[model samples]
Target: MLVLIGGAAGTIAFDLFGRAISPILGFASLNPIGLARGFLGTLGLPNSGAYGHLMHLLFVGLLAYPIGWLFVARPVFSRVLVGLHWAFASAAYGVGLWVFAIGGIAWFAGNPAFLGFAPIAWVALVAHVLYSVVTAATINYIERLQHAR
Candidate 1:
């Protein structure tokens, strides 16, 4: 749920920070919605906008769930065992997300040449990191609560 909320925030931020002002800022466009629309086909919709947004949300949840489970939530107590801070681990996971997902797969799968030259790529990377942070925090909270019960 937190991951979804963060994704919504990221989507809004992306549009607000996107190509509308690219003329003033040489690289300001990451169109996940556009990418979804192109990749997923029309889905019987007029322009595929709504379908794309839904798929984008699902993708966000799918991406964050495992990271939250495997990295942050799972290792929170283990960090204490190793004398490390949980936040440090979570942050590392966030950056790892950027390095692997946006920088690697999305770049290669989408337009490597264009992504390398775009500021939106960086913004999208941050968005993914933010999403991961929220997922980590939320899952940690839930785990704590479950234990408290």
Candidate 2:
């Protein structure tokens, strides 16, 4: 599914970008997946290593699934309108994820990588935007394929 693909891709992309600036920025690893892992830890799951990261990816992909479903797909040939809708919806959704993850989850989990008043915030903003756009595009592509079939 597009959600699974997009979420995984987004995580990799976000990690890559984060790694690039982290050394110069002296920032901690912006482990978005760890947000979910931390919650599981609090619940006595004690996830670690690849398992924890996989859980995080699955969590992200699952959450993204319904979002992609909600957008659905516009009529075929309405490329511009569909693009506009995807853009708007994805942007809003991305921002919501950023806020929820950074402002809510990270805050509660005591992870310092995603808080405000820092350069990482800016990087995260861009990363999230990229994520949403990719999610939208992937879902749209799948929908178009389904329609063609």
For all candidates, the clash counts are: 0, 0
Best by TM-score: 2
Overall local distance difference test of candidate 2: 0.61
Candidate 2: stretches off by over 4 Å:
20-29, 62-84, 112-114
Cα lDDT tens digits for candidate 1, 1-149:
54454444444444454435443566655676775564455344443678777766566444444445455644664655576555556556667766665565554545563367466667666655565555556556666877998
- What TM-score, over all chains together, does every model reach? 0.59, 0.68
lDDT per residue, candidate 2, 11-57, as tens digits? Answer: 66666666565545676445556666776676677667665666656
How close to the true structure is residue 85 of candidate 1, measured as C-alpha lDDT? 57
lDDT of each: 0.56, 0.61
Best by the lDDT measure: 2
Clashing pairs in 2: none
